[model samples]
Structures are given as C-alpha cells and as structure tokens.
Target chain A: MKEILLNSENYQPGLSIDCVIFGFHDNQLKVLLIKTSYDNKWSLPGGFVPIKEDIDTAAVTVLNDRTGMQGIFLRQFATFGSIKRKDPNFDSTVLDYFEIPKDAGQWFTQRFVTIGYYALVDFLKAIPQKEDNHEIIEWIDHKEVPELILDHKEILDKALHTLRIELNLMPIGYNLLPEKFTIPELQKLYETILDKKLDRRNFLRKITHIGILKKLDEKKSNVAHKAPNLYTFDKDKYEEVLKNGLNQGW
Target chain B: MKEILLNSENYQPGLSIDCVIFGFHDNQLKVLLIKTSYDNKWSLPGGFVPIKEDIDTAAVTVLNDRTGMQGIFLRQFATFGSIKRKDPNFDSTVLDYFEIPKDAGQWFTQRFVTIGYYALVDFLKAIPQKEDNHEIIEWIDHKEVPELILDHKEILDKALHTLRIELNLMPIGYNLLPEKFTIPELQKLYETILDKKLDRRNFLRKITHIGILKKLDEKKSNVAHKAPNLYTFDKDKYEEVLKNGLNQGW
Candidate 1:
C-alpha cells in the first residue's frame, strides 16, 4: 500500500472511479462488494485513474481486478464530488492502515471526486476474486446490502435509480415483461423495478400515449377487477423507440 | 497564468471544470465562449477546481467569474476524460502563454479530466465580463459557433444533445408549446429541437403513449389533412410525471 504513494506519478491525485456491478441470478439483483483488511464495511469495487488512462478504462480495470474477468456490460452513470466522498474516519483509519506518519500520506486524505459507473453481468459467470487473499469479496443480494464505506451506499442507490430510469428508456422490458400482459400487469412490472406504487390512471394514460404496446382484443381472465385488455409491445415501434429514445422525459 | 501552477496545491491536479453556458434570445440558443491572448480559437467558459471545493461549487465560481453574477441555473451534464481532453498543442501553447520553460509548468501540459457543466441563463440579464480586459468573450448563437480549442466543441454539442434529451425529461415544453396545439405541430416541436425529421406515424404513436398531452374536441380550421384535432398538456399529470421523472429512460 505504501508503494501507492511511492509511485504517486502513476495515479491521478484527487480523482477516482467507483463501479456498481449488478448481477441477476435466481431472479434477484446482486451487487459486488469487497471487504478490505483495513475496514469491516464493504465498498464498491473502485480505484484511481492513472495519469494517462481514460476514466472509463479505469473503471473496467477495477471490475476486472475484482471479478477476475472483463467485458462486463458497463456504463458511466454519474460522478460524485460532495464531501461525502471522504471517509469520515479517513485521517485516523487510512493513516493507521498505511502505517504512515500523520503527514506522510496527505494524498490519501484529500477529497476525491469520483466518477460512477454501473455494470450488469451474468451472476453465475462472475466469480468474486478470493477470500484467501485476505480481501474478502462477495455478491450480496441488493435487498440485503450491508453498511458500506464512504458514500458507496449512496452510489449504489443512485445506480439502482439509474437502472429504474433505464427501464423507461431502454428495451430491457423485452426480456423482463411477459409477451402479452394487461395494463395492471404492466404497471406491476414498473412498480417492481421502482419498489414503489404509481398512480393507476396516470400510468395507463401515459403508457397508452407512449404507444410502445399494441392493444389486443384478448383480456386477462381470472382478475378481480374488470378483465383488462391484453397488450404486447409494438415490436417495430418499441425497437424504433429503444433506438431513438423517448421524445420527452423527466 | 503561471500562478496556476505556482499555486498548484490550491487546485485539484488533473481535475477541472468546464461550463457550457447556454442562453436563449431572439429565438436562437446562444453559447458562451472566451478567447485568451495566446489562442485565437474560442473555448467554453472553464477553469480548474480548487483542492477543497465541491465540483458543483467550482462550476458556479466559473459562472460567477465569467457572467459577473451569481446563481445561474447550472447542472453537470458529463465528465470528459479521454485523450482528446488534452489540447493537441497544450505543451507548446500553454507554455508559451505563461512564458514558462517546457520542464517547469508540466502541470499545465497534463491531461485534464474535466467535469462538464451547463447553465441556462437569462441572456439579457447576465452581462459578459469586459472584452477590453483582453479576454474576448461573447454569446455566439449556437448555429454560428466558431472553431473552438481542444474538445470544447464536443462539449458544446453534447450540451445541446443533453438539452434535447431534457426537452423529453424536463417540463420545458410547458412554456414553449402553445396553450393549444395540433399533433402535427407537436411533432414539429420535437423535430425542431432534435434537428432531424422523425417518422410521422411512429412519432405520433410514441408521443400519444407518453401521455403528456390531452386531446381536445376543437380542431384547427386551417387547410390540412382531416383538420387535425387540437391538444393541450395534461397539466396535473405532466407536473406529477416531471416531479417524479419519467418512469424509465436512457
């Protein structure tokens, strides 16, 4: 770790990258977390960009190092630059971790403006690097995410929020939604992604106006309410939209 | 200029902020640009972030310095950290500007991972800092944007692209779209912002599905195919969706 400072020329000081790597297995979303020997709290896989490195490539390197692989579905989502990027116990915790004098590793103590990237990967394929190395890593179910260091929890939440918004913009629904579904069922799909209730009338009106779905004569049977009209994504239109994006949005 | 490196500890090394300040006047979007003495080329209003300052605050300070005012409507759009971020002639041009030896101000020659921020300001209200001070600043119409130094043009184009996306996500059309309009007119509004023609049938279907507009019984009398029905924004629903954001998007 002391070599990090000894070879300071290789890194871009005050800037870093954090990644929220998501995986889906058994129908549950999972996030990659690592526990350093220095702290019990887990953190998103992350690292600094070298002086000549592209920020995006730096994020890829972090993911590659932890997952022991590369070419995961990745994207830049947001950059976090608030004071929150600083670990609350940094001066004591990090200095203690490095076994450096109070003033020796001032570089590590400075606030980092970190770029955030999120990736969706096949859960079964991604293997956490190793626990024997003393750096314990695991894929925690998102719902069970534990306490994290710095602003990582916030970063994770933002990535999930971005994923929800992406559900609106991208064609991820083609894989998630049923082939034929009613307006109520469609609303449920959205609600499941957001983890919140949305207004029924507005949702119906808005979904209808967006025209991604083609209403069919069939109706879903066995529902308590009136048998709602069944619909399927207008394949051509949805593809066109997933290509062009929504005309207007949030 | 030399003071930038002389007081290097005051700023975050290799990290900077660039603002694409956009203004609307006389029915055209204008962008703010500045030309320094050494460079005949124009560039977006930009500066470095201080070591201890928030990146957002650094953006505001850049806005304050150039606009000679505070509280401009600003938000970060993206961060540029590719090799293209380094000015092609940074070593020669920047060193010449500061009259420093090639070896001395190496910091100025380094690659900057700049945070991109864009501001929409009241063009008439905000005054540009004086030109006589040798910084030739102007609000150039977006269409008439001149050749810029570095990746400033890419940054500006991206800001415009983000604004187009904002037209979908933000409640901007509440003010731009007339109180009552036709579907064709609405389609035209989108095409105008995007600067490209959209397939009429697909656009109509997608726009209606988004559910932001309300169909009205009244129809335009002007000669047209079937006298298209007039429409108005579904005010309550639009406000609700805007506040919450589009259910999902790219």
Candidate 2:
C-alpha cells in the first residue's frame, strides 16, 4: 500500500488517546509499561491518534503495538489535558536516557493534548511485542509502580477507578483470567483489586446465582487444602448478565 | 469582579466539553437547545474550555449556562473528532442557517475538536438563559428534532444510550421527576424512556427495595382512581444505594 500523508510536515492539533493496559497476576493488580525507544524510561502503553482513526481506535492501536493483543475489554476512563501537561519534561526521561541534545526534545514534546483510556486483558494472553529499537516491557504491580514518565500515574489511577466500577457492573474476570479457573482464584482477583476480604460462601453463591459460571469436575493437581472445583465462564450467560448491568457485588 | 473574556479567541487550543441535555415531557424525550446569538438554528448546550477548568468542569459550565441548574448528574459520554468532523458543512444545517461566508466558515468549523457529555434533567427545573447572539431557546422533542446544526443528532443518540444504561443500573428518576411523585408516576417515567411496559407490582417492589424514596403519609389528590402515596428522593439513602452497584432489574 502506498503511504498516505496529510500535511506531512505537521501532526494536527486535536485530541489523542492513551491506553493504560491493566492486568492481574500473583494476586496483585498490575499495569503494562514500555520503555520508550526514544528515551529508555518507562511509559504506559500508548501512541498518537491516527488521522482517520477514532480515539477509541487510536487507543486499541496503542495496545496492539505494545502487546500484540486485540479485542480486549477497553474503556475510556478520563481525559487529561492542561497547559502544563504539554511541558517539555513530559518526555524528559526519554531525552535523558538517550543522552540527546536539549533542543532535540522539541521535535517530540511540542504542544499536544491527550485523552486517556483504560483496558483489561488476560495476563497470560498478552504477549509483549516490542517495536524495533524499543526497550524491554514490564508488568509492575500497583505498589511497585515507579514514577512513570509523565502524567501516566494519574492516568493509571483514573483507570483503576473506572475498572472498579466496571467490575461491579460486569463479570470483569473474563478479560483477566484463564478460560477455566477455580473459585479461589476468582476470589483472589477481586480481593487484589478491592483490597478487601470476602466471605467465600457468599461470593460463590452470588457468582453461581448469576449463572455465568459452569462448574467443571476437575480438581487441583496439588494443594495443601481440599481442592476447589474449576469453573469456566458461560460466555452467553455472562453476556446476558452484562445486559442487566452486571449486578455483582464488589 | 473584573469581567473575564470567555470567547474562544482568549483560550489556547485544547479540548472542550459539549453537553447534550435531555428532558422527557409530553410523551417524548426533549433536548434543551439554543441558536447562537451570532448564528441561526438550534444546537446542543455547550461551551469552551476554561483556562483553569478541568474538562469535566467545562461540561458543568455548559450545563449551567443553558439550564440554570447545577449539581445534577452529568456524564462524559464520548469524544467526537474525525479529520472531516471539522468540515464547514460538517452536517449542513448550521452552514445553511449561517449562510456561511465560504472562506471563513471552513476555518472556524475545522478548528474545533470537542468531547461530548450528556445529562438528564427535569424540564421543569431547566431555566434556559441565552448565551450567544442568535440565542433562541426551545425544548425540541426527539421525534420532532430537525437536522441539527452539526453532529448533534449523533451526540443526542449517544446521550440516550448512556441514559438507558444508567436507568438499568440504578434508580435515576431524581433527575426526571418532580419532587413529589407516586410509584406509578415513577414507573411511567421508566416505561416512557425504556419504551417497555413493566409489571407494576414488580416495579414498585424493586424501587422500594432500593430504599431511596421517602414516602409521605399523605396520598395523591384528585385522581380518577385510587391515589398512590407521594414520595420524595431520600438523598442519604440514595447515596448508600449507589455503593451497591446493581439489583434485580429495572
């Protein structure tokens, strides 16, 4: 395909979308971060808005570029813009890491505005695909989240707030868990994000009554305690639950 | 206080918030609209980004300007910008109304990139204040809606979609109903919006269980049939119910 260009010398001034891809592993809610090829410091998985692409599409493209994943559950959590948001220091970490001249930074961090989107994906299914010259990818737990390159920390917090609301209104585990998982694992995921203990029996009853889980007769291979039954989400039933606004308790 | 310049020229290029305010009266959903003092025909209530304002605040400003109401529920529904979204005849209604000066029209239209928000308000409470030059205000019901100024029909559709979801998740009647109402009055509001007949007894049971209503000892007066008890929204209880994300059904 021939390369398409519009006003080639400049990127248009308009809205841009950024994605904060969140996942759960080892009982900790984590976010995917990339070390920018331009500057080696960490940044959330993100990209520029395509001239023809919708803002939502732009966010999905960012997710696809960084993780080689698509069709995941993504949502617009918030939009962040301030005159201060465009400060050159927004990409300072990248500049410092590459030992580039101060003047070179202008080529990238010039005036621009961004809208933030948050997404949830199964950690096991997300394969990090670094673009050529890009640095390694990392999944850092919320506690260990370092000072991200720019306004990313604020973006991540907004994503988490949106995620919590989505969880109560949908069977959120579908995007964050394997096809078949034990009830204990499901409970762990909720406890991790909510940071609270749940009565296992009540949680089990609620999930089962929602009729989104089909219990499997399988048992754990090895464990100190009695093994819990494995269950898989009934996709059709779950979709129906979602239509009624996923009334599950947090 | 010194008068602040609120024109678009005084601000830097940034994202702005536009509100699509909807009201239900006389058997149809109505939108609060105005013709700009400088232009012709109607458009959704909207405004520019205030220098120190959060984008959400900008949306509230749009709400306050046209409706003279505040602290009601307003939600950011979507962001609309495609390169072509800037075209002078983006939807033609505005172009023909303004009799666009061919040269300048293209430039002005293309400059804006707006994030859309929507709110549900009781028509009785909205006090429309003219903000711009061609500022003729009216409540245009959804069915009788004209070819709106620009991309506004799309904006209104999105607002409807958000309101539908909100209705299913919670009792959102406080925004649409008068302070004193009966169970049937509330049910009628839902039936009208959702366009479905609900089981009367079941609907009443569900809403009462939410515990957000303060039932008055006095009953409805001058009705052809048995009068239902009047009720007001219990703010404290409603806030408590919000913590519980879902329930049986609408």
Residues A198-235 of candidate 2 have per-residue lDDT tens digits of: 89998888777778898888976677788878889989
Docking class of 1: acceptable
Clash pairs for candidate 2: A39-A94, B36-B134, B37-B132, B37-B133, B37-B134, B38-B134
- The top-ranked prediction according to DockQ is 1
DockQ for all candidate structures vs. native: 0.31, 0.28
- On residues B1-250, what C-alpha lDDT tens digit does candidate 1 reach at each position? 3454533477777788899987665556678899888778998888887777788888898898888877666878788898556666754655665566676566766778889998877666678884346668999988999999878899899888877766655544554455777787767656655678889998777666668888888998876668878889998988887777753332
lDDT of 1: 0.75
Clashes per model (N, Cα, C within 3 A): 15, 6
How close to the true structure is residue A157 of candidate 1, measured as C-alpha lDDT?
97
Per-residue lDDT of candidate 2, residues B158-186 (tens digit): 77877776675666777888889888888
Indicate the worst ten consecutive residues by lDDT in candidate 2 chain A.
A1-10
Per-residue lDDT for B24 in model 1? 60
On the 0 to 100 scale, the lDDT of residue A250 in model 1 is 20
